[model samples]
Target: MKDLKGKVALITGGTKGIGYGVAEALLRQGLKVVITSRDENAANEAADSLASKTNSKGAVIGVQADVRRLDSQKEAVNQALSTFGQLDIVIANAGLGHFGSIEELTVEQWNDVIDTNLSGVFNSIKASVDALKESKGYYITISSLAGTNFFAGGSAYNASKFGVTGFTQAVMLDLRQYGVKVSTIMPGSVSTHFNGNEPSDKGAWKIQIEDMGELVVDLLKMNPRTLPSKIEIRPTTPPSK
Candidate 1:
């Protein structure tokens, strides 16, 4: 925690949402960042933009990774390790949602949500375990309040996020002995294009993307002895009511 200048962070699904916001904050803090996107073009674009803004020597690198696959996650780690040597933080942020009634939700839809939201986190941690251990760094999972608050149409998303919360807690205990801190951030209603929707000005009432970015940085600055294992965030005011 002495300096973030030379530290490296690997963030998944870092294009146009909370992940990108975190990348921007880390870059501004002078940290080297590797941002992954499922699409190569988007990843490269984000990396270049970050590099220009950060102006650190070789500050940003991007890789195409699909978090649902272990091989893709391993490849992302290899890219980070080969380019940056050590990983100081790993953010498991890639996720998707498909809303429907339990009776109406298709098998394919359920698997898609679970694979990306839950299995993706598993892949990310498994991939970076060694590098993070060597650096004694941080591991953060971007979960959702859906993990705790389940609604009628959120069956798939709720199940996956709930599992993510449970898994992250158990993994925290396992990694704590190795000096790695694991935590989960559960934001209630973020204004992001989580389900392939476009974010508009009307979304302003929800939590802003930069808020979670600030939260991540704050967590990093906290004392190492104190681990904020689970954080629940909600919008201060809801829909002017």
Candidate 2:
């Protein structure tokens, strides 16, 4: 495994779910973590909880910022740099989903999905690209299977995730020359509190948050010469509907 001691990472939408899981995984690898949430209290609380869980005091910090705004993203990145003194990794994990038929989907819902899932990623990468370039770091985004397989009532969500997958690929090409690695992980049916649904025993067959966390750590440990530009992950045994 790559020695990540003293490395620093900034994760967006990190107060809970997959983001929080990844933060814990990185912290275990001795990486300083900065997590962001749109809610200040949630961000701070999650950070504190993660620090306690990981037994890595002073290794985690929280920043309140919304990914939809470039300024907010920039502030989060700046906080990571100022706090940790360097930014080695950026996980653009902030996202949302609004599933509905085209006609049934409200404009606000479409925009929310687009802005958070697609534009939010763009804003995140733009804000952190310079710092990542300086550190020759890694940039990873959390996309979804909807990006590749369209389903009914998934118009806006599919569009946004498709955009994320494509945008991340293009960025990998653009940033590779700078020695900065970029990749996108597209997961299917993760068991998280996403889209206002609570994760329960019934969803146990789906991919768990810790699975994604381990995937991120594995990516970070991969040989620098080899970059897995795109990864698709699914549960080994998804329940039949």
- Work out the TM-score per prediction: 0.96, 0.98
Which regions of candidate 2 deviate over 4 angstroms? Answer: none
Candidate 2 backbone collisions, by pair = none
Instruction: List, residue by residue over 19-51, the lDDT tens digit for candidate 1.
Output: 998998888888889999899999999888877
lDDT tens digits, residues 89-185, model 2?
9999999888878889999999999999899999999999999999999999999998999999999999999999999999999999999999999
For each candidate, the alpha-carbon lDDT, in order, equals 0.91, 0.94
Highest TM-score, which number?
A: 2
True-vs-predicted CA distance for residue 198, candidate 1, Å? 2.5
How much is 232 displaced in model 2, in angstroms?
0.4
